[model samples]
Target: MQLSLPFTTLLAGVLLALNVNAVPVAQQPRMVTLPLKRMEVRSDEHPRILLQQQINRASKRLALMTGREAPTEAMMTEALRKRVLEVEGPEGLERRRVGLFGATKDKRFNRTGVPKNGKRSPKKGKNAGNAGNAGATGNTGATGNGGAAAGSSAIGGPDSATGVEVANTPTTGNSLGLNIEGPDVGYLATIQMGTPPQNYLILMDSGSADLWVASEACQSTAGGDCGNHQTLGSTSSSSFVASNTPFQVTYGTGAVQGAIIQDDITVAGLTLKAHTFGVTTSETPDFADDSVPFDGLMGLAQSTLSEQQTPTPVESLASAGLISDAITSYKISRAADNLNDGEITFGALDTTKFDQSTLTTVPNVNTQGFWEAALDAITVDGQDTGLQGRTAILDTGTTLIVAPVDDATAVHQLITGSQADGQGGFTVPCDFNQSVALTVGGTVFAIEPQDIALQPPNQDGSCTSGISGGSFGTSNTEWLVGDVFLKNAYYSTDVGKNTVSLAKLV
Candidate 1:
């Protein structure tokens, strides 16, 4: 499939690079460790409410695919209940719940209190005592923020968040958790931009590469504006410089437009000098809605996928010799009702994030710059549907598993109760216990049933499914597997080697 380019510009132009001869070259280190912080960006919103909003938005896309008006909430509720019965039989209806959003009062859904901080106390993990070795410095077991007092070389570099030590690295890749909220909302990292460094939380997305932030000039319609989110302004930073490069990117749902600018970006204790990024001058109304938690997005896909036509942070790191490899790994955890957790490792894979030693690596098939691979086959309860040798994009920005119509129909038919909602997706029984698996690199990885449950049941017994039907390419075999499958597996992408590896997370 030809990789879809997200950004489309009205005016034809060229991005003129500015000279940076006077920029001071900063010293960097080999390895850096940053303890990630789990943020309650939307503390007041309930998970069910958020899920409902996502469903509503998805319905619009469904409308486009089916050539019909968006399904009404009541219609969706009834469709969900009917799908459950079709996929799971009469017994499935009996398994329905009457709790919040028809959620099974399952303790997992009602988790409360302050969520666990992503910044785990370094002293609590097996690596707690190993901080000395964990530090970028060699041989010395230097204690970090939460471990022991930072050795003279490490102490007081940055404020300790749960005893996390942020220091300069001589070289090597940096790894940090990519937090998850229920499904694939996104994992966020904090980067300080501008001269007097102001922090901006951005989503690390691999589906497209373009670093952008909301700017002070950002404007939205009456219905758009999410409250309290941060935006950047060049005037606030003494080091900020306008590159006069016009930039814009369109997302699956919205688009952002701005001009390119150069500033410093600090991530995982390493700073990239005179880094070029976008400051959004305009955005779609949806992005300003409360549903979005982060201020901006940071593209981590291959530079080829980038709209800026420049290297991404991960790519820049490699060019500057800050990391050992041009690779990125995602370990997205199930956040449930309270605790949001997960991480992303830049430059190299972190073995501790996975349950297995061997990674199933496959050659990337898309030349346009997506982490796409051939689908060996799909198995449902050990039965092959004969859907094999197809290609699919492994995307983290998406939440559902999307496949072409015929293939999706075949898979849905295998599971007794699944049904097409006339709207682009299937409605499956929340309680259905069928084994759904995907094969790549000659390895079959089973998907946990819970991972396929897109939305909880409502009081009326309606539940949204995690798998949907959408066409990325003309072929029926083209697919898109998002958090529905990613949360259950370990995904690694190496731009340098041009390969994508996946394994059961265990």
Candidate 2:
């Protein structure tokens, strides 16, 4: 069960050394382990529902940006089943390809003019610009390939795009523990900030790389919805320095606007002096809801993904020598109760939580701060479906396992009585007992049926499919493996080495 790291491509970033089988115990001090807990926001809100909504929204965003027509509920269901644009024969495929660019099934199906792939259509054509655009830009859904991360805002990309950007830079050192708030959505950490070290609750998001909180000088939309929450008062902190740098960030949930500033921060017994962060001047309606539990979010993605234009907490810790490497590990508890049992460790892996020497490390393909890897194929019940040539983004921020329509459909087809529910997911018999696994770096990792069965059955008592339909970008094969897959695997990421490893949790 020795962990094997196969280097395909090398990129600049932070490094993470888990219980490397080769790294002796004395040398493992470079890594640090932290306890994590699942914070439950609403007892009634199932984790699948919350995370599914995020995936669905992200999928629509990709479609809108790509200029795809809004899909009908029926159309979406078919797409999830990978039955869209079905070709019955060679003639049908040719006709379908012609219709793919712009021919609708209406009377004009045979009359409208559409060019072949990569061929430019007439300037007056509605899909002129869309033609030859095999390479579209945007925060792709799980099915995106060879594209920057969704909402990347990469070095040269738009400043306010989807996905987090990865920048190779040193960090301003600091450290502290976070308060576990809502497990149904995610975890929240309490960070000590300001001169007197006022405690501020923030969501610890590995998918994002920006640290922000509501400021006492903030404004909200209508109802006192700006969340009846505490704020970080600049005047109250003697060490606060206002930068007035305009800052804004968007998430699947909502967006926030504020100014960048530098202040002292503390977490997990580590103090970061003059750490740069954002103070919210305005927030979206989503944040203002009273149901929202956390005050702000502290991003732990790679430094390159930081939207505040500064180093992330882990990067800062690495720069300050507080941790050995730029690595993070998550152990999300699958318990439905508010046990607060999940743990997120920085700078190291918790040997207690994973099988001994069972780690498998793969190269990260994208530099946009997403923990993505090259996927070989997927197997259901020990049969390969040839779902290859795709990249898998290991997202802790997401709840369901999202894949390109075809791959998702293929996986769902293996299960008996699984069919699309018209809401970007499939409905399956709650009693499904099959093995679904993904082959990565030549290793086969199986997902238990219990993990794949989403809770809270429909009126018919059938459960929702753990696999959802979505595209990352122009690519037809991008996969987003969220908590559904992670709950069954020990996931770890090393920013320094640009590698993501997965081990079957014992």
Candidate 3:
């Protein structure tokens, strides 16, 4: 599919230069690792709700990339709510405890508490009374505060919750750590931005290409609630350069709009100078919730997919020769594992994380700028489902697998005691142990039963399958393959080679 570029004319020359600069060879290949922290699951946040959100995000991502008019978060949520009510009845809705964006009434208002000198402060706006003040510490829960302490480097101290300590000084050839929120909701990396360098927890996404963070202007002007997350702009950064160009991006669950700006961004011990990205002045509640751990999002897809029409961080690193290659790899961890051992490596693949003997590489076939490859087949309990010609978009931002409607039904029909939830999803017995595997590049990657049958059974003693039905792309065979399947393997993408490699996890 051809991507309808929004700012093709403006970015044409920049894109050409980036492509040329991406080819220079480096003396030594460098690898930076980002450790991941698993989020504490809440009883109120249902797995089904997360599944719906993932579905919405996948759809909107495709819509935005294809230049289609994407539905607003309100429209998407209302549609889901209406669908649940119509198909499952009011009792089912109540049983699932479904609310706007899957957040309960009280959960929406339950903001993260900011402690001052070991005492909890009253509920107030993000950095209240200290808006636009770089020195003021913002939400310091799960992730550390946004403000950099005096005499402190860009990296913050150890996070008590995750037990991971970020180095105070930038280390050469070292990897920054990442926090995994919820059951693989997304990966969070603490990045320093601006002149003085304030820390911001950013969601690293491979499915989309665009970097953006909430701005202090949003919090100070009452333009929108940025929650207690960190923010940066001219108010907080002396070197921040703003453009008159407007920036807006819509995700499946949320949306943000602001102005294009240029600033310095440091990630994984490497700095990308004068990086152009968005500084959000307004954002939806999906991103404005204090319970949400990430302060912003960093899209790792190719520069062509970038809405900002700027080279991605990885691309910039490659162009600047900060890294030997424009490659990113993920060793995602599951909440069930409780290991907190997940990590994302940039520049080069970590051979220690995967079985090199079983490594297989496939060309990325999606022209619309997604890390996608052909899915040859799917087998349930060692039986072929006869499905064919399907492609899977490996997305880290998504939590579950979203398959085409017919393919989802075909796979679920093979599982014993599987029933359609009437909402484009299927519920299987909680104790489902059927062997499921996906065939890609003629290699079979088996999925664990725990990964297939999600946690927390429904009131009817049924658990939601990690796979659901959804529509994306022109053909119905496209699948949004997320952490549900990715966690079981070592997934990596080589931007320069335009190939995706998957290997058995060691």
Candidate 4:
């Protein structure tokens, strides 16, 4: 009873079977946009505290890029402490702490988790207060008011601890809204996860590559609760699958350690099934601060830069045919401008955000995974400063520009009345208005005078230069270019092309 058939027919049947079992073709990709919310700066926040945080964050970012362990917080603080003593004498350190932590009548500084008077000012846990908005859904402008869930709070109101007003009701579209916390802070975006979908606000960081969130059992490295932020895990999501792989990432200000897992994640009306990410069991206190607006961070850098060795969320979207191109664009807004219209677009550029005719594309030079490009020149008042052949890393996560010590000194020297502040920064007269422009890819972009000088805590007529001097890992010719410079331009990164484009804002 053997079956008989022509050779051509048999071959045709075999081919048909193979086609049925083979992988399906990817669908066409479309552009997706997300809204960004801006978190205002706290009236009580000290400039010195922000400065130190930026310094530490820059140091950590460099270390991570170079595959080295960053200096311990104690070591970094000790170095700054020595500088203070050398410049301001014995009492300078205490005075600095008082300014940063706020001084009580008795002259004692308020340290977190430390006893104030006889009672301890306990750190707020995740369940202590209401969780904010459950996140906006669809393109209809529907806002979900979160219940008294463990980590829920009312959206579009002042944060319970920080008193920073958060925006509510993101515009309807295939976009997730972004929140800009402050001038120097990074942006945050809302995302949905799990079977039924739970909303969480996470940082939209392009400087690093890895997605992570706190788990239900998470604790602070300081041996306390993990703040009043949201948490996710197998308990909250029935579809969560544990990978049993250990993961750890250390930032300049904080670190997290946990296990890698898989689940469904949705952003901007697109979903990635079985997406891989980290669930932190422990984190540093910097991230566990109750004032911190985001629950976790989602890195938008190249996959090679991922500490977990997994594809980034954007990459996953491209692979799944969710986006046509691996492009991410940012139109960050200034708090002082009060435009409140910052946004991030994935897959394609929002042509309306910038002048397409002025777009200048440059090759990304750092093969080790940063969005770095060459700095052609520096100009002050249209006069070339002779600074050339240096490179700049366009980092959205950072707040200020950190350049090599020699380069920073040279740039500052060109400005009148600019002097070293002895704290790795420079101070200039508040009224020193000059056109400072940076040349890249033969295109010149000017930085606003206001953006170059920030008011220091002293209320004196002097300002702290937004560009500071520091060493980045082992590269003395590299610059960490942050929002200070980026806010002046329309920035976009193309992973597929391995290039970065900047254009004058419209």
Per-model CA lDDT versus the true structure: 0.54, 0.54, 0.63, 0.64
Could you tell me which 10 consecutive residues in candidate 4 have the lowest summed lDDT? 12-21
The alpha-carbon RMSD values of the candidates against the true structure, listed in the order shown, are 11.7, 17.7, 8.7, 13.9
The whole-model C-alpha lDDT of candidate 1 against the native structure comes to 0.54
Instruction: Tell me the TM-score of each prediction against the true structure.
Output: 0.68, 0.69, 0.78, 0.80
Candidate 4 Cα outliers beyond 4 Å, as residue runs: 1-29, 43-49, 63-75, 82-92, 95-172, 472-475
Please estimate how well model 2 matches the true structure, expressed as its whole-model Cα lDDT.
0.54
- TM-score of predicted model 1? 0.68
In model 2, what is the error at residue 218, expressed in angstroms? Answer: 1.3
Whole-structure CA lDDT of model 4? 0.64
In model 3, the clashing pairs are 33-175, 34-176, 35-177, 35-178, 36-178, 37-179, 37-180
Q: What ranges in model 2 sit over 4 Å off?
A: 1-32, 41-54, 58-184, 223-225, 337-339, 471-474
The lowest-lDDT stretch of 10 consecutive residues in candidate 3 is 12-21
Total backbone clashes of candidate 4, pairs 3 or more residues apart or in separate chains: 19
Candidate achieving the largest TM-score: 4
- Measured with C-alpha atoms, the lDDT of residue 336 in candidate 4 is 66
- Residue 377, candidate 4: how far off, in angstroms? 1.1
What's the ranking of the predictions by TM-score, best on top? Answer: 4, 3, 2, 1
